[model samples]
Target: MKTMILTTALLALTAGSVSAQQVVRLATEGAYPPFNFINDAGQVDGFEIALFNELCTRAEVSCEWVTTDWDGMIPNLQSGNFDAIVAGMSITDERREVIDFTQNYYPPAFSAYAAMDPDADIEGGVVAAQTNTIQAAHVAETGATLLEYATPDEAVGAVRNGEADAVFSDSDYLKPVVDESGGAFVWLGEPVQLGDGIGMGLRKSDTELKATFDTAIQSMKDDGSLNALLTEWFGGDDAPQF
Candidate 1:
């Protein structure tokens, strides 16, 4: 009986340790360009991917990345398929009810773009964002219809094709797009009223895991590994501040 009791105790201890070292799975919308996008090589690349790699290494946790649709990322996260979310998800109050977020990894800025046409008479100075993002909401307070797009690329495409006056999206994405467009379009260069910083999302039930992630993030920030990786992916001047 004593031997059986000791075995049970050992098993309990082992299980406890395993629980502490649980595998961490991360999810992202592989469609957000310059953030987390599917590259021509059909592999995930960009700012969030590089950042997640550094974070996992510093946290001493093994990680796996799963591609998820933007609309489904939060729902899937709530289902327990992943331990954390590294997607470029804005840390908003609506999301805070369901998940806790770590320190933001990028700043929040919006840029408006429109096709180059002298007669277009785009009245809004520097352009305005869509109506959905926090920036858009700010634009709305000013009574401007922040142009909305189904996707970031759609917004870019609108400007490229001259469909909807103009479209607004994250500035990081706009930079690459503007370069790729080869001067066909013009960026209005208006910084929208939005907060900088992207957060790591964790299930509200996993407060301990959130704490672990924050510590890892702070360590990376202090040691410069995070900055090095950012410079490699986003260029030194454009890297988002942690």
Candidate 2:
């Protein structure tokens, strides 16, 4: 999943409440590139990192980054481990049942299939997807045998190593791989749009923080800064602007 990936166990939600904390801690997967990833400096870097900092500045809110594994991301947030999550997580109805999300920062993107073999059977063959992602859910409905991986990289690796016929994921993440694979990878079929878009996930009670960030995000869009940031990270053509 490009825009959305990973699934976390549903741990018991702690009845924790946040007030005007001095430092607003935000977490990211630190694995999804162009959205969020660890850099050579061992720091979280990418579009979302840049966006978080800028948004915090605009909102006059003190904030810091926290790196967390994607598989248990939701549970950690629910348990008061972080103030928010912005790790390319999608805004879906099912997810909304667990947590609240601000307006989308990234527009909806199509999920596609990629494989070493061009004729890979995406319709009913073995398909790889990140565990509990929209892609995996979609694959399950497509009548394909879904292979779930804890990380998107592992899902792609399944396709590369012949463990899966094709891997279904967000095209933004896979397009670069296919373009740079030297013919080792090719798209298997048409892409399908999933989720509304990507957004910041917060606990249901964090309405004030959500309103603050939402206002900041809308300001960026109003001032044309959001479009510029989108272009900088995802290129003008592929990334949807405000």
Clashes of each: 8, 1
What is the lDDT of every predicted structure here? Answer: 0.63, 0.84
lDDT winner among the candidates?
A: 2
- The TM-score measured for candidate 1 stands at 0.78
Q: Which residue segments of model 1 deviate by more than 4 Å?
A: 1-21, 108-115, 118-132, 135-142
1-242, model 2: which lDDT tens digit per residue?
12322223222222222244456778888888889997886777899988877887777766767777787788889988888998999899999999999999888888889999988888889999998788889999988999999889999999888899999998888888899999999987788999999999999999988988889899998998988999989867867776
Q: Any residue pairs clashing in model 2, and if so which? A: 2-170
Worst 10 residues of 2 by lDDT: 9-18
True-structure RMSD, every candidate: 9.2, 6.5
lDDT of 1 by residue, 111-151 (tens): 45444553344444333443345545554555334565545
